[model samples]
Target chain A: MIGTEIPVLAVLCGDRRPPDMDAVEAAAEIRYTDEKGLPDALRGADALFVYDFLSTAVPGAWHAADRIRWVHIASAGVDPVMFPELRESDVVLTNSRGVFDDSIAEYVLGVVIAFAKDLPRSLELQRQRRWQHRESERVAGRRALVVGTGPIGRAIARLLRAAGLDVSGMGRRARGEDPDFGTVHASADLVRVAAGFDYVIAVAPLTDETKGMFDAAAFAAMKPSARFVNVGRGELVVTDELVTALRAGEIAGAALDVFDTEPLPVDHPLWTLDNVVISPHMSGDFVGWRNTLVEVFADNFARWRDGRPLRNVVDKQLGYVPSGH
Target chain B: MIGTEIPVLAVLCGDRRPPDMDAVEAAAEIRYTDEKGLPDALRGADALFVYDFLSTAVPGAWHAADRIRWVHIASAGVDPVMFPELRESDVVLTNSRGVFDDSIAEYVLGVVIAFAKDLPRSLELQRQRRWQHRESERVAGRRALVVGTGPIGRAIARLLRAAGLDVSGMGRRARGEDPDFGTVHASADLVRVAAGFDYVIAVAPLTDETKGMFDAAAFAAMKPSARFVNVGRGELVVTDELVTALRAGEIAGAALDVFDTEPLPVDHPLWTLDNVVISPHMSGDFVGWRNTLVEVFADNFARWRDGRPLRNVVDKQLGYVPSGH
Candidate 1:
């Protein structure tokens, strides 16, 4: 038997219809609010789901509220929201970790194919009305190193292997398991392993150890023909080092889906590079992405109401450490 | 112990290189002829390998030689050179099959991902400096039907399955078993099975039965959201019907690697449509492709000289059917 007395739930964001809300509640409605409306919404709320990126923009009175028992962020990564107040609070924090796995994985594969098959060249030729038939490289039988073992990383690895690539993954702590994937390597071994791979993908979380991880030294260690893809936090890679690597031909190319600054400036040198493929951090934004977020929140809500451990619970000490550590 | 006397072989095309010529001459040295220099080169030839696209245009004297006991085509499909004179002779005919499998398979996957993720739209937005994020469909759990069971078709099927799609292949004759693939359907069942698939790929060879196989009726039977891909032969699909299908929204989109006429006439209406992605029949072309062809030819040469059955031998009755079927 389920409880009929629903706790007050506050949603922080614009009124984009949350996915699976009908299945989540018949009469258990959630109170929606913007940043200005947050204090009122959180007055008596027991749980909060933050969908607005502005929630962490300013320290709000809601953070001091003692009634809030759990906070759910409708994003795969919570690095931006990890403040000392939220980190030190007794409130449990959960993220939409699994939501973006497949979509982002698809994006990685799409970019890889685009580069390998010379789609950009084809597009350029099409504009000129030229019928050029050129041989392109094959994705098959190439070795790849995925430098993160989270859901998104694993998904990319799976898709790459399916395309006949030799895919290995790296984690914070290598367990030597993962039978479906190649040998799991430790982060310390990345530089040594990177040279043998044709592709190196960075999907690691933004941590003290991972920040600026792909620096000049790392790029210098990769093969000249290898490609680098970074879908993780932007700060995880050193932009200047990446530019140097590309300019010096240390790596063949690089694809960035995130940047140190949001809405990358038009004058940025990244847009000028022929080899770099820049995306506006939209890899995880798919047709039903909002619905997926709602579903995740609903599932977590049910777990919280039943006094069960919340799913995708963020490690406060590690500051957004993924589960299955 | 082997014979000390090397057999003299004539190559119809003069573009033979190391790996390819080496492959052909593993058992015997091959003397090649330019189309303009054919008579001199074919004088004392014991075997001939035809690599020219204009083989049918060759002078009558080259085909009349009784000393030429074997003939091999460098291309996969041998319909262009299948004259009644060549078919009736004791001359052995072989083809370069399985050489282009990985490249074509990579191309198919590339185009499929491009369509699924709206890469064209993304690129357009990138050019316009717009950061519009939209939902995209995932390739996982979707169904794909490859309408040909040849090496190219099977390779496409393998690659798609690896990307986590449910793939079914239809061949000219259903052998009922393919260890590398699943659910090999006969050609007659294609129309009935068309509706259930999310992707339809035409990879069948060009034949009397397969010519114009993808007509209005086939398009009508397909789901409105399904995407069609053709990499087999241009003649296998009715291009007019495809244009109509895209216009009427009978299908979501289509990517064509081959067309009824190549360099697909600039005035063709298909180019005007936003949903169509056209490639110049170059899906199988990739770096090192020429070398792969040479290896295939060389391997078959050893069997030919040892008085053993050659690989990829065409069955004249079935029009380029692989022998031993």
Candidate 2:
């Protein structure tokens, strides 16, 4: 039975609010607040929308979400929102899944091409006004291992395949015939099979089993000619092991978009590595992305208000939207 | 009828000779010469191979080629050998065509992705150890106009289209349908249709009629956001006009692998432009490319020896291998 009183919606925002907040205002009373004001803002809210996906205030203010029946984050990765209390609660969780797929896929392809063509070396030479000519590798016929079978990883696999790469995928389960990836290898066999590929890409969701998955052993297993790319969560890789691998030439190069710490401190050793390409976690953020994220939230909000099944509802035990549903 | 006499082959080389000159030694009497030795070497030669494609000695030595029957260049472009003396002569001309097609196409796709993702900026920021994150444009759905429709250009068109770009082509004539390009626009209509594209790529062969085609007017006609890429001969574009276009913001950027002058004088203004990416004319010179060139010439030599029709025989009148031939 639905309650007769008007439902309350709370939005946790940072300096910037979600675009077009008016779309949800008519359906529910909205309470907007910063990280510090989250507790008071969530006191009577029945549904919480995490507009500031980077904030860690939610876990601390979980006690105030007394009336909350659902929680949604404006990002594909829901790691920050999967706190112990929330996972133990009856509240449903959903994430912005489809929004970043194509954008991230494009980013991955860009970096892959960059590595094969040695674009970074060209740029470095450009800075010195040098006209040095070097032979570049062809991406066509090269092998790539995509370390996740989720939408983002699937998108990356498809784009890479389209760009003439022989691509395979690594997922929770092994399968022989996937539409995007013909062979899906189990994540457990990553180290054993990693040597066969020229490019290894990680787009896995962050979970207890996945944290620090790319350690020294995995790096040592990769061929010296291989390139490692991570557009997934930073904690998914062991940063020190990667740095050591790059220093020792265990891998030819790496294109990292995420790190354990944001803004990857200026003093970090990875900054000085010639073969490493670092991006500030902006792989999926294309122009007008913020507006699109807001629209996704509003559409989901309408469904919640009408008591309909939400899109992209996460499976708490699995820590992500499962393959089937 | 095949010639009964042993054919004399003159090889115009610089510092390096063809990798396996022994392969053709059994078929002909080989005379290896540098630019200065070309005239003496060409005397009484039945065929001349321009191993130093960069050398301009062929025209000067034309007076000594009393018995020369065929001239083959070790490069796709036959600009150096297309002089009045040779063009008016009965000597057959062939190029190392198919060898560089895929490599050059890969380079074109690399620059396109670099421009779309602003990888150059990312590298520059990396140099400064800055962690600035900027939203990048997606290459998918972006319109690209390939300026040439030969093998190299067709390869680029197909690869770019596969990578999710909407690709079209510019050729001598317009057609509603082409296997690689859905619509082939007339080269004469470049300015009129140039504005519709996000990228304008030049892979047209260097010929009298096509020289300096991408002038100020052509640059001005392009969208301000468009990027220009040239993997063709340098003289296909007017260097000064291109500099003006880039300086005045008529176009967003340029990736030039070929320039009007080899070595691109260190003082050239193009080296200073933040938006320009200058590579030293090595787009198609992949590893072992010289060996492949030798192999192609050897195969063509065998066909010549057997009195059979040869592959990649250029139509001197039109300056390239015609599409249907």
Candidate 3:
């Protein structure tokens, strides 16, 4: 029954559409729709491709996804599409996980270096045409705690260690002798273990247990000279606590690519803080990333059509693509 | 001759005096003076310590150095003290060279990553409270041409390679299968070979042969997307040509730590350019760098007192501590 009839793939797109989708188009009948048209498009589709990974319309229109046997999102995190109805169903869920690993890893390393070298201050001084000299901190030999042990977090750990940083990881369970991260501390011990790192990078997925993991206590555990970087989901941190921590000098700086509310309001205090470096949630996006995202989904679609084991299959219970998959 | 009469050490200071000089003060009869008092202080001194490495008054006071046997500068480059008399005389010249290697290497990597990740732009947008998402480039697998084969350049090569860049070297002579840089291109071929790299980092010392090495021709030879970084002396670049190249878009961007002039005038055109990142000539100066510089000089002073070979003796004619020393 897998290939007996051509499967319909409902492609959910926002203002921007995925590029290089010829292969996906050829393999399945593609139904393109915006959020408003998603329900109609998904009425009898065998699969749903959430090209607009940022949209939260899926949960509201879940009733129309009755025939959706498989769902693929063009993003690493499944938070946007992990609706309760879908989680309870037998439908398979996959993501574009490995595609963003190295790219985000490079971004993490870049921000870490930026904070260490005081590059933001240099650029600001450059803008003022000032020639003031200041001593900068060295990135090498600094301790960094990567708060996720997934492929993306592992990639970051590898790159940071390569740049001479002592790297450790935070995961579901404490373990030793990990490949990329020498020691993996349990996520439950985040508050306790966070004190030892000069840089605490949050790359954990958003789940019931992980949401608001980086609160006032976590920031308090960090050294006043420590920096925080978040390339993970925004809700993984408490925004108010981070703001207070930064304002009171509990932490030295922060480089945030994601926010609880993106395009973070114009009057938001984080914009005015000299220590906070904010980007519009594009850490993993390299040139031609859209093409890569489409390719990942297309390759996965081919596998599904052939009744083969899908890549990056998310364990609904874990809320992510579990380890050793 | 060896620690027999307790050598008279003249320490040349500017507004800031060297800190933690207790050892040097105890080891010899120390005479501290500013530029104006330098000539009188050097009249009977057996050795001179150029604590203020930026001063050009050494040549003006060279006549008073009749009893001087050695001069140690607190800088990697000996450009300020490479006067004709010093180069022609039997006087030994030593510089603080190795101390800056890893620190400057980290700075070079930081700027490279800053450019690759568009961090400067992110900071600018953050200032304006704009959340625009842009695709950035990857640093890994990118080709880099380190235009100096000295310790600093070698350190940069090693660190960049660790960060996954394919690094080559530029030196006085071309060679293959080098240790840090796999391939070394001759400085003479910079204009021709500059086209092959994404980044060209100039860490060469200021010498007659290397002066103005990165001129208009070199800029024209590079890709329009290439970025130039200078952690070397300012005279190594033709400033006017660099300004023209930057304005005409011959090259994409430049991160200049050194310039033809210190405290680059208030209304310089380079400061107005959006593509240029200007920093004071302090890339190698890290936290506690002054202490390290002083320690280097103290250790060299001990070797001089013992009549043993100095650690960083500069080849006066070559203008730098040459490789294999």
Interface RMSD of each: 1.6, 1.1, 0.9
lDDT of 3 by residue, A1-325 (tens): 1767889989999667789888878778888999999999899999999999999999998899878999999999999988789999999999999888998999988889888778899899989888899998888899999999999999999999998999999999999999999999999998888889999999999998899999999999999999999999999999999999999999999999999997799999999999999989999999888999988998888889998889999999899999899
Instruction: Arrange candidates, best lDDT first.
Output: 3, 2, 1
Residues B200-307, model 3: lDDT tens digits: 999999999999999999999999999999999889999999999998999999999998889899898988898888889878888999999999998988888889
Each candidate structure's TM-score, on Cα atoms with residue i matched to residue i, is 0.91, 0.98, 0.99
In candidate 1, what are the lDDT values of residues A51-120, reduced to their tens digit?
Answer: 7653464246555355887888888778766777877878888888888998889889988988888886
Better of 1 and 3 by lDDT: 3
In angstroms, the error of model 2 at A226 is 0.6
Better of 1 and 3 by TM-score: 3
Clash pairs detected, candidate 1: A286-B135, A287-B135, B20-B294, B23-B298
- Which candidate should be chosen as best, given lDDT against the real structure? 3
Model 3 chain B: weakest 10-residue lDDT segment is B1-10
lDDT, model 2: 0.91
- Chain A accuracy of model 3 expressed as TM-score: 0.98
Q: Kindly report which residue stretches of model 1 are placed more than 4 angstroms away from their true locations once superposed.
A: A1-6, A15-17, A23-29, A53-55, A58-66, B1-6, B14-30, B39-44, B53-66, B174-181, B323-325
Q: Write the per-residue lDDT of candidate 2 for residues B159-229, one digit (tens) a residue.
A: 99988999999999999779999999999998999999999999999988789999999999999999999
- How does model 3 fare in lDDT? 0.92
